[model samples]
Target chain A: MKVLKGAYSGLIFLFLYAPIVVLIAFSFNGAKSRGAWGGFSFRWYESLAQNADILHALRNTLIVALLSAVVATIIGTAAALGMHHMRRGLANFMLNVTYLPVLNPDIVTGISLLILYVFIGINLGFSSLLLAHITFNIPYVILSVSPRLKGMNRHIFEAALDLGAGPVRAFFKVIVPEILPGIVNGFLLAVTLSIDDFVISFFTAGPGVSTLSITVYSMARKGIKPEINALSSIMFVVVLLLLLTVNIRAGRDIRRRAQTHVRSHSPRALSSREH
Target chain B: MSELIRLVNCVMAFDDVTVLNSINLTIKDKEFLTLLGPSGCGKTTTLRIIGGFEVPTSGDVFFDNVRINDVPPYRRRVNTVFQRYALFPHLNVFENVAFGLRVAKVPKADIERRVRESLDLVGLRGYDKRASHQLSGGQQQRVAIARAIVNHPQVLLLDEPLGALDLKLRKEMQIELKRIQQQVGITFVYVTHDQEEALTMSDTVVVMNDGVIQQIGTPVDIYNEPKNAFVADFIGESNIVPGVMHRDCEVSFAGRVFRCVDTGFAPDEPVDVVIRPEDVRLSPPEEGQLDGEVLSVTFKGVHYEMMVRARDFTWMIHSTASEPVGARVGLSVRPFDIHIMHRAEKTEAAS
Candidate 1:
């Protein structure tokens, strides 16, 4: 049974990541031919370094990702707070509206946003792309944050208020800290989503505002390039590092909280013994 | 004595259903007043109204002769130690206690001194830096108390504050709370469903049922002279026998005429006779007021609870003596121990 389980897990891993592995392997191939694997070489890495358009697109992608992540986090946190205080029916309705952009197909959202921009006579550029990314990214932030808000003990807020801190101060000193982990997780999710997006950007992004994903698509359409492999490898590594750092930080924070909880409760056990 | 807070004909309704109806109470300064009731009897609702968390419908809340009906919870000169303690998880004991001071914009040095003093008062002197989430349930409760008392509000409201603790912890905290009340000398409006807690802690006990004040008196007065069936039943364990009031100070129950100290009831008025378990005594069959067979005997740590079956009803009597099951026994109750209350109407009975 254990052997069967091991084989099943192995098959699942292959199904999930085999394409990515193949892509990475091909990127490192030193062969002149496209299909055949070659001995490992540094040609792709050098070509990737010299690519100006790819670098520009990467910079634009980073800017858009960072901007969207910040805007989404602020708006989503506020939305979460508003929803947390709202009546159940109204909150749920608002949540459903926020999630519509996420649930709808990318093509439909992209087209609708394009039409709205045209009707309003708004120019589509980096700003428009960032706005589109935020529209879709906020729902993920809200979903992530709402649960954390709900999980938090409401007594904390009441306690702060009772202690004479006004509503605003209590939100910053108590409510925000309690929900910080959720906020960080949501921010990371938004950043990842913004970075990897292509379909929405394709419709909203104007000339000279191409992102990394757009650059990758255009490059792939022309033909496979060795430099593309290096770029993909770099993107994969950066994302993996970001995920690792966030997970580690989150895990540490959880452990610290648990430790503090245990330590505080332990003194009672000691006092009982003394009594 | 000056009236610290008063609820005049206070009525609270939620979704067209009355939760608190016509609650009239005047809490005196420096009095430990408890609102006692069974679950969902609106004791908590009344406390919430006084704390300014819930506004009474069609009534007035007065604080020191000033109408406070429109006052928000933060603006009320009262603080509540919520049932769950509600200590801020993010703030340490010091910061949590000092939060109100900071919000009121007290000087930093004064805030620090007051926070330290409050923590010391709660016997948590050296643990000020510890986060509230790290504190034990009892410590969390003490922190909650410190948080409230540091502000020195006129009235401190406790909504079953010790209900979450275990028995031993609750007892310890009860004494601590009474001591804190004494030291602070503030009006305390405590709410609880536990009769023992109310009896042990409060100077005045207000027994309530279904949103109405049933009786308000000293703890001894409430326990000794409950005005109605709900008050008698809720204050403690009582054997309520359906009976008829024969005349002034006389009630007949279970084929026996009993002398009671209660009055002002019309003759032949249907009533319920209340006798606490500890008030009834067991003796030889011929030496007591009534004779019955012992249905069961339960050994409580300090007393033996004997269930005596008399006629169609069973009387629970608390005694130290062990009695064999099914043995014939005599049960007697003193006249002063017998409290008579008019029987609840059919609608009240169903509730």
Candidate 2:
């Protein structure tokens, strides 16, 4: 049974990654042909950097992801903090309202945001695309932060206030530090969603400007570009490196804490012990 | 002593569910007062009101004769030791204790001096850099006390601060806390569901249930002379029986009239009488006021608690010696042991 389950997971992983693997391999092909064996080379990677259109699209994608993620994180975190102290029924109702965007289909959200932008007669450009990304990214941030807010001890906030710190000062000093891990997780998740989104970006974006996903989708109509594969492969490697660094840091922290607790007692213990 | 804090008919409700109903209480200066009740009995809510964490729906709260109903928590000169301690996990012990001083923009040297003093007062003098999570439960509780007291607030509100500790540690901390309160000479408002904890540390125990105060008195008065059936049952082990007050120093129960040192009830009025388990003396069946067979016996370290059956009712009796099961014995209670109280409404959990 274990072998069967392992085989099932292997098949699922291969099914999910097969196309990406093929793309990465073709990016290194020596000749311009699909399905034919060609010696490996780095020509596509070399050519990708000089391609102004693809580079522009990459820049646009990076800008939208960074800005949208930051704005959405701030608004979502503030909204969660405000809603945390509200009456329970009202807070629950507001939370359910926030969940609607996350539960609704991307196509529906894309269409509605498109309609609203058009109705307002705003010009559809980089601003419109960034707004679209920000609009959809907020719900994910709220979902990530709400659990941390729920687990927090609200009395600490009151304790801070009671200790002569005003409201804003208390929030930054006490509340922020407690919920920081959740906030960072929410920001990262928002950035990931914003970077991969294409539907809303397509509907809202104007001509002459494109994000990485939009550029890739447009390239697919004629034929898949090996240069596009090269860029994605680069992105994939960067993400993997980031993950490795984060894991190593977290593991070292845990080990250090364990050593401190198990190996050495605080000075108070030794000082207070009787002969 | 003067009044340090007063709640004048404070009423609090969320939606239609009332949590505190018209509570009027005064906490005197330098006195240890405890709000004692079961979970959801509004004891914690009362503490929160005093700390200015919650505004009453329609009442006033006075702190040293000044109405503070609109005052926010930051303006109130009171600190609370939360139930969970709620120490900042990011900071070290020294930093946590020094937070209030830093917020008040105190000088660096003054903050250091006061932090050292507070830590010394809690017996954590040399441990400045220890993280909160690294400390034991008792140590963390002490840190919380130090953190609150370092500010020198006029009143310190503790909400079951020792509830998370084990029995041995909790008992030790109870004595430690009482000593600290006396040394600091601050009015301490403590809230706990543990009756024993309240009795040990409080000068005034306010027994509450279902959003209302059942009775308020010293621990001795609360135990020896409970005003209602709920207060009597909630305080300690008791055998409450239905009785009638015939007249002064006279009551009737157990199918016969008995003399009790109680009065001020209408003639032949129905009442409830409370008899503590320790007050019942047992002897041979032929030489006591009532006779009963011992149904069960369990050893309780210092004494043996036995269940005696008589008149279709079971009476719990605590004795230094044990009696064999199924042995019939006569039980006698002194007249002062029979505490008479008027009937109370069914507002608390059943015994």
Candidate 3:
């Protein structure tokens, strides 16, 4: 049974990664042909580095992702905290309202946001794309942060006030620290979502304001280039590293929390001896 | 001690559901006053009002003769050791204790010295670098206390700080808390549902029930002279039964007239008679006033607690001597141990 399970998992991994592996391999091919690998070389990577349009698209992606992630995290965290303190009925209503955007299709959100922006007479460009990303990212940030707020002891806020810190001071000193891990996790998720988004960006971006995903799509019509393959390989590695870091930090946090919980409940004689 | 804080006709309500009704209390300086009651009795609400966390719906709160109803908690000269020890999880012991001082912009050296001193006060010396989560419940409690007291607030509020500890640790912390209160010479407004804890650590015990103060007095006074049946039953194990005040010192209950020390009741007025379990002395059937068969007996470490059926009431009597179940025994209570109070409904009407 164990051998069968291991074989099954190995096959699933291969099935999932086989295409990506082929793409990565072709990124190193010296020949321009799609099928023939003349030998491993860095020619595609060198070409990708020299592509100013791709570099500009990458810069746009980073800027939008970073800016939208930060803005969404701030707005979402504040909204979650406000809802957390609301009456149960109102808080539940607010939470369901937050979930609506997340549950709605990305295409629907993109179209609606485009319509709203057009109705408001705003020009479509980097600003429109950023606004759309922020709007979609806020719900993800709220979902990630709501759990941390729920698990938190509400008394810490009152304790801060009792300890001579005003509302803003206490929020920064105690409340923010308590929910910081959640905020960072949400920000990372927002960054990934904003970078990975294509459907929304396509609908929102103007002629000159294109992210990396849109640029890749536009480049696809000109026959797929090995430079695109090299670029994708690097992006995949970066995303994989980002995911690995998030998972490792999350696992460490859970383990540390469990350890502290066990330690807190350990025998008094055992804990006192640590002194 | 001079008066430090007063709640004059304070009425607190949440969404039209009143949690505190016309609460009038005056806390004196250097006094360890405990608000003792069962859950939902408005004791915690009273503490919150005094801590400036909750504003009274329609009343005045005076701090040192100045009305502070509109003051925010951060502006008040008060601190609270929360029920679950709400220590900051991100901060270490030293930083948690120094939080108040830092917010007040105290000198760096003073903050250091004061944090160390407060940690020592809570018996957590040399634990400055320990994370809040690393400490046990007892140690966390100490950190919470240290954090609150480091500010040197004129009044400290503790909302059932030791409710989470085991019995042994709770008892030790109760004594430790009393010693700390005396050492600091600051008013402590403690809240708890445990009557024994209130009696152990408080100079004044305020027994509350149903959003109203049932009785407020010294521990001995509240215990020996409960204002009504609720206070009597809540404070300790009391065998309260209906009776009629025939005159000044005479009351009748359980088909027999008993002499009590309570007076100031109208002739033939209905009252409740309170008898403490330990106050009942057991003797031979022929040598006592009320004879009953022992129904059950259980050894309670220091005493053998027995239930005896006498007339219409089952009397709980605590004695070192064990009475076998189904055995005949007699119960006699001393005149001073028998307390009489106006009936609860009548008292409410009068109030």
lDDT at residue B53 of model 2 (Cα atoms): 85
iRMSD (Å) of candidate 2? 7.2
Deviation in angstroms for B305 in model 3? 1.4
List, residue by residue over B210-295, the lDDT tens digit for candidate 3.
89998889999998888889999998899988789999999888898888788789999988888999999999998888999999
lDDT of 3 by residue, A25-116 (tens): 99999999999988999999998888999999999999999999999999999999899889999999999999999889989988998899
Per-residue CA lDDT of candidate 2, range B1-351, in tens? Answer: 998898999999989999999999999999999999999999999999988888999889999899999999888889989987888877999999999999988999999999999999999988899988778777888999999999999999999887767676678899999999999999999999999999999999999998899999999999999998889999998999988899999999887788889978999988898999999999999987999999999998999999999887799999999899999999998998999998775632343
In candidate 2, how many Å is residue A123 off? 2.6
Clashes of each: 2, 0, 0
Model 2: residues >4 Å from true position, as ranges? A1-22, A25-43, A82-108, A219-226, A238-275, B345-351
TM-scores, chain A, per candidate: 0.86, 0.84, 0.92
TM-score of 3: 0.95
Question: CA lDDT of B251 in candidate 2?
Answer: 93
- The numbered model that scores best in DockQ is 3
Error of 1 at B166 (Å): 0.9
Q: What is the interface RMSD of candidate 1, in Å?
A: 4.6
Residues A6-116, candidate 2: write the lDDT tens digits: 999999999999987887788898776777757989988889889888899989989999999999999999888888889899999999999999889888888888889
- DockQ for the candidate 3 complex? 0.51
Candidate 1 residue spans exceeding 4 A from truth: A1-50, A87-105, A115-124, A206-208, A246-275, B346-351
Task: Supply DockQ values for each candidate.
Answer: 0.43, 0.33, 0.51
Clash-forming residue pairs, model 3: none
